[model samples]
Target: MQIIQSLSEISGRYRALFVDLWGCVHDGVHPFPGAVEALKAYRATGGKVVLVTNSPRPRDGVAEQIAGIGVPADAYDAIATSGDSARLAMYQGAVGTRVWHMGYADESDDGFFTPPAILDDPLAIERVPLERAEGIVCTGPADPYADPSEMRPQFLAAKTRGLKLLCANPDIVVDRGGRREWCAGAYAQLYTEMGGESLYFGKPHPPIYDLARRRLAAIADVGDASILAIGDGPQTDAAGAMGEDLDLLFISGGLGAEETGTAIGGSPDPARLERYLAETGVAPTYVIGTLR
Candidate 1:
């Protein structure tokens, strides 16, 4: 893989960029030093940027959180979140209206139960038990710091009832200021292993990419040839790019850094990165130590 110093090298080649949020833009706690500036600079050069994230929050909620986390309003044009995509699946009648949401009642906002503000639906959402609901929707664990193993029984029980799970975030884990935290994908993976069917609407899944593509198309007339997906996770970001036939720019400092034997926020190691890439078998079009 080619190790690029700056996104500008490939910046001119693409009219639009689908940038990942958590790892590439900011850690859960703070924005990366040069990440915001890089995106702002890209937009200033007439590039349309869409913040694509596997966050289970609705697009508006994600946007607000990012803004609070220090990413300026002008850094990107639009946001397409997995929560929004998952809700669309529900709206399209892919799953039943009544959902048994598996996430923290306190940590979650109304976005988890209601439609996005863009849709302006007047109906209020009500939560039900797994037996009463027609399907399961897991935004994440009930506790932010809870282990995926703690929720295994619940997932398996839902599976026994033939309930399909809608995984809003397909990220197995994410870095929360250098600490790895379990995400919805971790639970979904275990559920799948236990013969549970799941519908994922995030990175590495075509549905989320399709939502991102539509958001990008709304702002600019760009094709897949002129679009690049920038992210740090190989299984989620790079694999998703590959599935959507989009180019990938992988950052080797966040979620995947551990596999490369590189500590979080450390300089990139070309040798270890190469080995890690080979192990994962996901080839990115470009590689950067971080999203500068």
Candidate 2:
């Protein structure tokens, strides 16, 4: 893989970018100034940026959250979230009408249940007890910091009942600032391992990419050949970009910093980076310590 110092080295080659938000742009609590400037500069060159995130929040909700975190409105053109894609499946009855909700209980997660305005007719989805539900809708664990194995009993019971799980965010974990936390994909992986079915809508899976392409198309007529995918997650972003046959710019300073020996505001150690890429089995077109 080519290790590059800045996005400007190859920015002119792509008409659009499918950028991951959590690690590449912000660290959940704050925005990365260099990353923000990179995107803004890219936009100034007439490039469209589609923030394709595996966040379990709708497009507008993500926009609001990012804006609150200091990422300005001009940094991106549009957003396509895993939540919106999974919500479309849920409202289309991927999980039966009566489903059990698994995630944060607070209002911060309420946007996931909101029906999409684009849908002409969405099913009347109901949040019911797991015992009475036909399927499960998992945005994430009620407690992200807790071990995923803690849900084995519930997953086993759901499996016995033949309930399918619709995983909104197919990310195993995310680094919120400096703390690592489990995500919906961890729970979904556990459920599937226990012989339960899990439907994923985010990265490495085709659904979210399709949704992101649609969002990108709404702004520009860019094809996969002219689009670049950027993210920190090796499996999610790198694998997804490879699956979609798009070039990838892997940000090593985020999730894989420790493994790749990437220090903050610095590039990764070449030997460690090669080993990390070999182990992950993903080949990114370009690598950078951060988005800039």
Candidate 3:
């Protein structure tokens, strides 16, 4: 697939843009080339852009991280993250309600633009006893899932509690420096397999996009179909766009290099690709190797 060459083509078609962070804009370490300019050009042509990500950080925290990495703060209008979404979902309850942060949250986790109870110590969650817990919000560091054996403890904990598991990042795993790393979703799947109930609040889950649209509506009265969702992962990004009935710019550049046997995601059979797309019940409006 060809890279999206210029912003002009994307200008008229999309009213507002919901762009993914992490793999699409940065590699967890640095920003991609021309990513900022791409958003600037999109906004220059009268489009409103919102950075939609599954990052476990809040909006301001996300903006700060992106800015530190070279993306211009003015390039996009705002951000919406799964962390904030999870927090929102958590406190839709009575005041002073107890919640177990079944995950890790740091100083950066504060000032989320929405505040909720945060318990950083995973052991506290394990030792605190489950009866006092109202709900379990799982978001923590997952690294080097080289062997499933390494992922055992935490996986077993959530399963043992079987409390309402809130998966902040919907992705099962992601690549870090060419090494595959797990995320909240891996345990989430295990939790489900072990008959533990859970709720995923990010990509491939339509409610996130729904929340994003409602947020965007404050700027412009746009419909869902007019919102373009862009991302690098075909499964999460493309599939999520499909779930929301939005157009997709399936970026082929990033982690998939191995899936394609040429670029991102590595080598995979064409039939498998077709099946992946078919299962979503929504198709991309365009496919590109990069956002350009």
CA displacement after TM-score superposition, residue 200 of candidate 1 (Å): 0.8
Root-mean-square deviation of every model? 2.1, 0.9, 5.2
Give the top-scoring candidate (lDDT). 2
Ranking by TM-score: 2, 1, 3
- Candidate 2: tens digits of C-alpha lDDT, residues 1-292: 8999999999999999999999999999998769999999999999999999998889888888899989999999999899999999999999899999998645466478888888899999999999999999999888888999999998889999999999999999998888999999999999999999999999989999999999888888998999999999988999999999999999999899999999999999999999999999879999999998
Model 3 is weakest, by summed lDDT over 10 consecutive residues, at 119-128
Off by over 4 Å in 2: none
lDDT of 3 by residue, 1-292 (tens): 2235444576588899999887777776667666777888888888889888887677777888888878888788878788777666655531114455544433334543254544332121222434556555667543335443454565466557656777777777776555677777776677677676778878878767776887798789888768888886666777888777788876655555445333432323445444544654436776555555
Judging by TM-score against the true structure, name the best candidate: 2
TM-score of each: 0.93, 0.98, 0.80
Q: Which ten residues in a row have the lowest lDDT in candidate 2?
A: 104-113
Model 1 error, position 107 (Å): 2.1
**Model 2 steric clash pairs:** none
The C-alpha stretches of model 3 lying farther than 4 A from their native spots are 1-4, 93-108, 111-134, 142-161, 261-282
Per-residue lDDT, model 3, residue 253, is 59
Local error of candidate 3 at residue 135 (angstroms): 3.4
